[model samples]
Target: MHTVVIGGGVVGLSCALALAERGGDVTVCEAGTLGGGSTGRAAGGIRAQFSTPVNVDLSLASVPVWESFEERFGVDVDYRKNGYLFLAREEETAAAFEANVEMQTARGVDSRTLSPAEAREHCPQLRAEAFVAATYCPDDGVADPHSAVQGYSRAVEERGVDVRTRTPVTGLSPPESADGPWRVETPGETLSADYVVNAAGAWARRVGRLAGVELPIAPRRRQATVVEPETAMAESVPLTVDLDRGVYFRPEREGTALVGGHFADADPDVDPDDFSESPDLAWTAEAVERAADAAAYFGPETRVRNGWAGLYAVTPDHHAVVDEARPGFVVAAGFSGHGFQHAPATGECVAELCLDGAASHVDVSALSLERFESDEPGTVEQNVA
Candidate 1:
């Protein structure tokens, strides 16, 4: 079957690679350069500490790929398993962490709850007295998204897949008949495909409209800044998160760290094409201050060196919609902000949906777009940063 995959970010490239691996004719259409969207701007966090089972399952299915990416793809993605530490200041949030750890433990994730003192053991600079409780997962970590994109892009092209960069999809339509091919129109030419996979990242909602499907994906801008800490941070320091404040920081190098968070009560959606790519000065100052409050490594002398902003394809429930929305159109977007880490599993599922008519790798039944139209839309992932 001829399958046309839209978007050339890590997720889209992954889907195209999976499709080609399954002996399907695949063509990847990217509006911009590969990994130029959310994939390139991602903080590269990988974790299985989600509150939802589906998300954890996605991590379970994908992390193994990341663990062996260098050997399998012949590309070094700078994969680091420095771990992720989540802090809770409120009693209710601490109780939720306990429940989340229990659930995570049952799913084979080596995560455990920690007292404030025990949390300090993992992160020496942490202000233990400031937090009521914390959670730590030694297996959860990060990798370079750009490197992963290079790996996947090369793999797909090697498999004889047509990867069209700078080719924006102008129109998309469902098949006219039950067995007719789907129409995908680009500026240069129109192509017909047996299947069309929408992996458009931040522009997913717009792409969905072209196919006459209304996806609840919104583009929300998130920023991260690199700061030179007053005190040298250990390169092995785990990605520390002040969950209550939505602030997080991870060691980037010998003495510098990447810090980010959304401090406002409201996270309004922004235009994907018009939003600022550079971080806001006010937000960067607040992010650093919040980081300083969480750990001693960041102080009044912390200097912000550089920063950039990216969009998150947010759904109302903060989970992805990875289902066949129409007869031959599949959606693998609206991952909130976890798309980069979950790309492998999502790609496998999208390929399965296109070939086997059901996803066998991960149970994506809860992530269907129809869930939004129903009364019980399910839970929203609380561990977003």
Candidate 2:
């Protein structure tokens, strides 16, 4: 069977790769260069920590792929298993932390609860006054997002999957007859496919409109900053998150740290290509000032080296929208901010939909579109910002 996967971000490339591996002639269509979306702008935090079994499982499944990509695809995505620190401020908030740890531990996530003192022991510079407890995961880490996506795209391309860049799908047409599959349009062209995967990332909702499906995925803006910190770089601090504040930091190129993660009240839905490469001074200032005051390791001595702003295909509940939205149409976008981290598992699941009509390893019904009919809670919250 021939499949046409739209969007060329990490999730799209992943689905294309998975379909090609399943012996389907796959064609990937991207409006711009591959990995040009949030995949390139993400902080690249990869971890097995989660508050849900499925999310933890997905992360656990993906970390190995990130770790072994060099061997499997002959590329290193700068996979660094530095570990993670989830910090909380008060005892009241520690309940969620405790629950998350239990779930993570149950799924073999190597999560362990830490006292305030224990948290300081791992990062001597951490301000113990800032938090009450933390859940540390040694197996969690960060990777080079762009490198990771490029590696996957190349590996799948070599496997006979057609990856076409600068090719945008303008519309989608389901077969007039129930037995037929799908038809899609690009720039001055149209094509047929047995399967159509809407891996369009932040633009997933727009894609759904083309096919007469309602995808609630919205493009929300997220910003990150690169700071040249004067403090000594920690080679092994997975990705540290100030849970109470929703801010995170990790080592970047050079003796610097990449920091950001406060949702703005003015979060806008924007075109994936409509991004600012230069750091936003206002946003950077806000993040740095708050971070410096919160952690002893942070200070005004740091310079804003650069910043990146990307779109998050946010859902009402923040979990990914992954399911067969309709017959012959699969949705695998709206990963919120965990797209790069969970691409492998999601990709394989997408293929399972094309092959067996359902995944044997994971029950992804929780991520289906119908869940939004009642606008109830999501399946997972451990990974959402």
Q: What TM-score, computed on C-alpha atoms, does each candidate reach?
A: 0.99, 0.96
Candidate 2 lDDT over residue span 1-385, tens digit each = 9899998999998888888888989999988989987788888888877776777777877777887899998878888887888888878668988988887787777889998788877677788777888889888888888888879888888989988899999989898897786988998689898889999999899898998899989888788888877685566554777766767777776567888886454566666556666667887888877667556656757777778777888887778888988898999988887888999989999999988899755677778788889746655474433
Model 1: per-residue Cα lDDT over 1-385, one tens digit each: 9999999999999999899999999999999999999999999999998998899999999999999999988999999999999999999999999999989899999999999999998889999999999999999998999999999998998999999999999999788899999999999999999999999988999999999999999999999999999998888889888999999999997779999878764789899989999999999989999999999999888888999999989898889999999999999999877999999999999999999999999999989999999887688897455
- Ten-residue stretch with the least lDDT total in model 1: 376-385
Worst lDDT 10-window in candidate 2: 376-385
Score candidate 2 by lDDT. 0.81
Best TM-score goes to which candidate? 1
For candidate 2, the C-alpha RMSD (Å) to the true structure equals 1.7
> lDDT winner among the candidates?
1
Question: lDDT for every model?
Answer: 0.93, 0.81
Clashing pairs in 2: 82-238, 83-238
Residue 4 displacement (Å), model 2? 0.4
